[model samples]
Target: MPKTEKSSMSWLLRVIPWNTTVVLFALAVTAVLLLGVHYYMEGLISIGTLFLIYQYTQMLNDPIEMLGDQVQEFQKAKSGMLRSRELLSMRSEIEEGKEEQLPQGPLGLEFSQVHFSYNPDKPVLQDINFTIKPGERLGIIGRTGSGKSSLSRVLLRLYNLDRGTIRVGGTDITELSLQALYRRVGMVTQDVQLFDGTLRDNLTLFNSDVSDHMIKETTDRLGLSQWIDSQPQGLDTYLAAGGASLSAGEAQLFALTRVFLTEPSLVILDEPSSRLDAATEGMLQSAIDQLMKQSTGVIIAHRLATLEKVDRIMVLGDGKVLEFGAREELASNPASHYARLLITGREEELA
Candidate 1:
C-alpha cells in the first residue's frame, strides 16, 4: 500500500471514533438540558428534578470519555502485537555453521573481497580486505557511516556478508557455530544496558556459574574494585533498570566487566569511551589497555589519539579502505590520510 494512504487511513481510524463519540456526547448533553428545561417550565418536573437530570447527564461524560481513550489504546495495542508477531515469524538470515569451537588463544582475523549492503544499490562495505595478526591490535578510524560498526557486525556474524570470507585463527567464520563464534568474539559499545537486579546479577547477567571470586578478580583487574567498594551494597547493591543510578562511565565499566568474564579470544571496542568524561575515559582507557593486552583487539575510534596503542591503523571512507598500514608509517607520512588528520586536528571531527 502507498505509505501516505496507509498513514492517512490509520490516522482517520484513530481520530474518527473519538470525534464521533465526542459529537454524540455533546448532542446528548444538549438534548438532555433542553428537555429538562422544557419539562421544568411546563410544570412536568421540579427545578430540583431538572438539576438532578443534568447531573446524571454529566455523569455519563466520564465513562464516555474513558471509552474513547480505551478504544485508542486498544488500537495501538493491536498494531503493536501485529508488528511483534511479524518480527517473530520472520526467518533468520544466518545459517548455523558446523564447527563447534574456535581455536584457542588470541585469534588472527582476516577479511577478503568482502561486500555488504542492506539494500542492493547502496553498499555499506565494498571489497574490504584486511588482516590482523594474532595478538595484534588494529585501530579502525572512520567517519560516521563509514562501515566501522558494520565491520564489527559482520565479524560477529550478526549479518551475513554478501560476498567473501572472514577467517579467525585460519578457520572461516561461516564454518563456525553461532554459539562458538560469539563465545570467542566479543564487542563492547558505548550504550550499556543494566537490568533491575543486584550488582552481582547485573555483572554476571544472573549466571550462577560465574563465581563471586572471578567477578571480584575481573573487577579488580579493570580497576573497578574501588567503585564497587563505594557502592552502598557493593556487589549486593540493587541497580535500577537501565542503569538509572549509574553514570555513563560506570555503566560502561559494567559492560567491560561482563566482556572480561567471557575471556574472548578477540575483543572489539566500538567507541566505548566516546560518551565518557575525561576522568572516566582515562579509567576506561586504562581498563581497555589492560583488556587489549590479553586479546586480539580492534579499536574503532574517531580520535587518532585513541589509536596510540594500536599496532596498525585502518582508515575507511565511503565503504572502502582509504588507508591501512602500520601506525608509525601512517603517522610519519605527511601525504597519508592519518597524518593529514593529525596535522589538521580533525581526528575528533571525523564523526
Candidate 2:
C-alpha cells in the first residue's frame, strides 16, 4: 500500500471506535432521561426517585469513558506486541560460518561468478567477478541500482549469495566466523551514527582501552584537530544523539576516524562524501587518502573525480562488470566508459 493510504487507514482505525463509543454513550443517556420522565409522569415514580436515577446515570459516565480509553490502549498494545513478536521470530538468512579466524595483515579480496537477488526471479548481482590484490585500491563506479552498494553488502556477509564464492586472503569468506570477518573488513557509509554521550565516548565507542593520546593522534591525522580544539570541553564535550549537533562533513569525518582506529585489513568507502559540499569533500578526500595508504580500499563513488587517486577502476552496469582495468589505461582510451564519462563530465549521471 502507498504510505499516504496506510496513514489514512491507521487514522480511521484509531478514531472510529472512539467516535462510536461517544455517540453510543450519548444515545444511552438520552434514552434513560426520556424513560425516567415517562415513569415520573405516569405516577410510577416520585420526582425525588427520578432525580436519584438521573444522578446514578451521570455517575456511570466516568467508568464508561474510562473503559473506552482502556480498550483503545489495549488495541495499541496488542498491535505493538504482534509486530515485536514477528521481528523476534525471524531468523537471519545467512548462516553462521565456522568459528575460524581470518588471516592477519593486508587481505586480498576476490569474487567469482557471484549471483544474488532479493527476489528469486529478479537478480541484483549476476555473475559478478573481480579481484583486488593486497594493499591495492579499486574504484567502483555505476549508476544507481547498478549494485555498487550491493558489492559491499555481500562482502560484509549482510546477505548470502545465491551462487558462487567470495574469498579474502585466499580463504572463502564463508569459512570465517562473522566476528573474524567484520574485524578484518571495515566500511564507512554516508550515514554516520552518533550516540548521546561525550565526544570521547563516541570516538572510542566507550572503550577505555583506547588512550586519549591515540585518539588525539588519529583525529590530527584526519584533519579533525582544529574541530576538536573548537569544542569547549575537547573530547569531554557532549553531543546530542544521532549527530544532531554536528554538520554532515563532521559526521563523515567521525565515521572515518572510527575506521582508522580499527585498522582493518580492507576498507570500503561507499560514497561517504556524497552529501557534502565541495570544500568539505576536499577535506574528507585528504583523510580518505591517508586511510587508503594503510589498507586495501574499495571506493564506490558516483563522482568520477573521487576515483582519481585509486589505482584501478571498475565500471558496473546492470550488476555486471562492463570495464575493469588500470585507471590510467582506461582514462587514455577514448572508447572506454571511464574515458567517456570524464570527457563528457557526466560521471555523476552515468554512475
- Tens digits of per-residue lDDT for model 1, 1-351: 776886677778888999999999999999999999999999999999999999999999999999999998887787778668978999998997899877679999999999998789899999999999999999998888899889888988889999999998888988898888888887887577789899999888899999999988988898988888999989999999967798877787778888889898899987743556777778777888878777999988755557888999999998999999999999999999888888888656556
lDDT, residue 61, model 2: 88
RMSD of each: 4.5, 4.0
lDDT, each prediction: 0.86, 0.85
Report the alpha-carbon TM-score of model 1 versus the true structure.
0.75
Off by over 4 Å in 1: 1-87, 272-275, 344-346
* Residue 189 miss distance in model 1 (angstroms): 1.6
> Model 1, poorest ten-residue lDDT window?
271-280
Error of 2 at 106 (Å): 1.1
